[model samples]
Target: MPLVNRDQKHYPGLAQTTNYNLSSFKAAEIITRDVVVIGGGSAGTYSAIAIKDKGKSVVFVEIKNRLRSRTETYKDPKSGRGIDIGVIVWYVTPRVGSEPNTTGAVFDLKTGRGLNAPPPNQTAIGIAFQIYTQQLLKYPELDAGMFLPDPAPDDLVMPFGQFASKYGIEAALPTMYSFGAGVGDILATPTVEVMRAWGLSLISSLQGGFLTTARHNNSELYGKAQTELLAAKSLLLRSRVVYTERSTSGVRLVVKTPTGNKLIKAKRLLITIPPKVEILKRFNLTTQETSVFKKFLNTGYYTSVVKNTGLPDTLSVTNFSPDSPYGIPKMPAVYTIGSSVYTPGLKLAFYGAPLTNVTSSLPAKTVKDAIIASIKRQQTANPANPTSFNQTTPTFAEYHSHAPFWLQAKAVDIKAGFYKKLYALQGIRSTFWTGGAWRAQDSSDIWRFTAEQVLPKVLKGL
Candidate 1:
């Protein structure tokens, strides 16, 4: 509760960086910036750019060698067209000609064209969503925002399957399951937390099909940010925050780069990555800070592009057992939730779980094998197609693991205003937080929240 201005950890000749031994560190490599934004994803990149635009100095740091999430495009041998294996689209406001259909089909923002296929049957889904609307007044903070709302304790702790059955809304499960893609089986997630994580914007996008993708790929957006940040001399790709020194005056981070270790001293620290307790423990966390971070649950997601799948290019695959026809059946996770061809014979696969598990931690070959097995199973199970995979395994073209993501706190912690405490830690030790954990998962929303909410506090302190 004390203002950081009273703390003297930053005072001249005070204790050296307490988390890691500075005696063995090279002080000569120290670099200073007004802000050090970690995790060069949507929020981190946006924050770095925004800070620089404000006429302040900043350095962007990311563990990946590239500025954005790993995106690769494979060229189809026969068609010579690119197949994006990573990020695919952007969620933009619906254009004038675009309109939602009776079936909740999506329309492209630029072209204003609805998808060729109509939306799945969702009449029952609409009835289920009424529960959220009915409870809106109880949580006003979530009503007018793009971010997810803190759930009522009961909804927060209750799993999705139970929540759906309790309200006689089991029909909505499959419709909402895709929203839980890469997170895990929605049936296991806290019902409201899933709603909060995706927020209304994404739901609207799905229902109306207003989501837009970059011309090149999802990486294009990040590429744009990277170019801009590079022009500003604020990007540090392939950087790891090895140690941190926090005090009343500023935050100093020891970042390991491809070249060597460099010290980054900044007035504010904006961390956009999923704050895993193990990762956070690296910083000089007080017991209270550690405890709060430890309360969060982390998810694992792995996405990839593949070739030689040996399946017909025209066939679209969705993973489900033979028994479940209308709902997302309970499983460890949505193993290869869906697969679509980007070009002839080249495809993309997305796999993950709400909890940190081997599905995400396993080697790329193992995951690829599983996807092939699932595809073979689906093909064999289909009475209409009855096609065989020829016992051929798919070859991986690109692999990117966004493991230990979607950090969430317990319902009790959320109701206790965990975010307020999260924000309170902002200026404490001159560190701040952002990204999906603090805001919405979508890039558009994360950028908006960083610009509107996070940067102001950072600037005020600066």
Candidate 2:
């Protein structure tokens, strides 16, 4: 098993470039590698390490300087004893595990209803025990993070539909989770994502977060993976493929560097790139890959935004999700804005979401002011003091003047063929396959899949 550093949080980033004429630049170095992996996020890092373990030289590249896209911090103001933003981490559980006292309820997920038919007494605590045990397996420090007597040791206290009532609607749930009170879309995801978001949200006030070491950040894990690949001497930082020419001998890859350009002659290639068709088309992909790349060009994704609202000037509600907004389509219940995020009087990370054409798909805004207006509508106008709505935190997303409302805002979500074609592109050049959106979600999961499928296949004939 790949042992990731438990000390840090792995962050990813994607940036746009100013120099479009890079493709015309003169060349410099000549290098060779068994494999070349694009992207430096969780999957990219792990894939590089796994390939290196196969005894092949490799090269890894990134469009941005940093690994992660977003960072979290604290909100201003203070409560009597809680946090600055009122943010909390939440875990899912049945009735029995709440605390020193209080019964828990059990809802069968398969059936999606209360399961009180057969047994005389099947408490929710039974579930609490199962979750705690799972934690024990995932983390070595479980003993330090959990407490048995507390019923809510692993879950967040929820009063869903808070945003709905605040808006004087039948329910305010849509704005709370889907519209995200100006955060990211939290709809149509796997169960794990929902659980993780909820669990972290539940404990925001009490235990802080499922946080890693501050210094290491999550990059440490990827950094360690990079280290494992050191034997390959294949890492190419601050470099990019300017042009690729398929030659009679082999594939010739010309990459641009600060000092000069680099030419690499390779027997085979392995590429893991983003599903953005426009972005992928820039690279000199093979004919087969080019055809697939063109298809991806039409796809888009949603950029996420997370923010804090509903706070007194004197105290901010840190790490908290709004009551579930009733009617919104793609809002998330909770977002990981930050943890223990109290900085005298400033909120740290607030809102982020994928930006896409989905806004057009829904009955919202397609223009700027209209989008912001629609997004602002998603949140209640500050209940305690009606004027408080005007005093909300200024998030990065707001400054960009980008898509504000995230009801299916486009950024993360993509078309179906995008992933399938991306993965199939690997076969265009043997030993080359794309992962991430083409394969899986989690970094570790991507690594496992790559190692199982690609490695042995690459080694077979060679």
Candidate 3:
């Protein structure tokens, strides 16, 4: 059992409510738990496990059958080996000695060969990196969450490109652009938003080294978590919240599971899902919460694994635009097409698009068409290339959407205390929040924030 917070004076309408009609779920089985965690992604999964470890009962709900969202593994039918297409690397603290020197070469589509040019100015890049990192260090809270000073510094709110020029870190723009992939138009993004994408942990990883799973399958981590949650009978896969009611005292939800609908009653509601108004409308959001969430904007990101790409396994193609600043390619475009490290003859393509509207979507066919066109353009640019897409069409083995990602607000809203109001929603109506949207968009960083900051507060309430 958990203690219910009875303080509802500050928030009116903090009483029983539901998005759907009560008569519809009269036969649903009622379930009770101390906490109900929605969206079994990185933050949700971690928080549920931590809550259970703290001697509290928790029920984890996920729309998908799997736990991890970004980490997707495509098993190659030929080799029977898992090829990690999403979230391939993670950062570890406390510098991990020296890393191997890796070389990158720009392949010329017109020439069908690697460009014979000098590498980027290492000295300039190093200096720019140092200055950029020092600037990020000034706001240490960004590593975990957006707990900025009341009056955020001008530098933090300014456009990242302006910040780069102001600090003479133009040499670092390309690097940042690469690191900030999936975040459309990094240079135009607010400085703080860019920092959230490429924050302190990533900087440390650059200085130290990145770690990947031994089996090259990042999903293994979540698989283990799923096993633990299943053993505790705290997980509900292939389930979605069809209706929810949150009051100051506690919360109740009607979840549509694969087996049947189940009514969940809990003292606290932890929503780790992306809090878009369209998604949260069913949660019976307060006027203030609705107003805050409606302002959030997010980018569209997708990943795919394909074969017969007409690209050599040795060649790595990076989208570039000489016209754009730092040669960053335009949005709604293919970011990269590279050979899979473990699976030869297979290529992975990453695509990113800017948010046009709240409901903007990028179709898989649209992405696949773009990739094919790009590959054909490359092969046609150089007729001498032996491989050609004239006969064979690239087969898309796997495609995953990571959209509604990199959630952020306009500069005006951020400066007008958007985060302050957003964070204030915690513990209100007996509901809490944590996820990439609430914190930095990194698994490790989100876990730290959930465990160290959010879970403590949640435990105290319980």
Q: Between candidates 2 and 3, which one is better according to lDDT? A: 3
Please give, for residues 197-245, the per-residue lDDT of candidate 3 as tens digits. 6887888788887777767688989999999999988999988776677
lDDT of 3 at 285: 86
Best by lDDT: 3
Residue-by-residue lDDT tens digits, candidate 2, 324-406: 22223333211222222222222223333343423212221232233233224323433344534344443332222212221
Predicted candidate 1 versus true structure: per-residue lDDT over 18-83, tens digit per residue: 344444555566677888888877788778888888899999988777776634555556766555
- Lowest-scoring 10 consecutive residues by lDDT in candidate 3? 1-10
Clashing pairs in 3: none
Give the winner by TM-score. 3
- The lDDT ranking, best first, is 3, 1, 2
In candidate 1, where is summed lDDT lowest over 10 consecutive residues?
Answer: 105-114
Stretches of candidate 3 above 4 Å error?
1-28, 93-104, 107-117, 386-391
TM-score of each: 0.80, 0.50, 0.90
- Model 1 score (lDDT): 0.61
How high is the lDDT of residue 420 in model 1? Answer: 57
Q: Sorted by TM-score, highest first, which candidate order results?
A: 3, 1, 2
User: lDDT of each structure?
Assistant: 0.61, 0.38, 0.79
Clashes of 1: 7
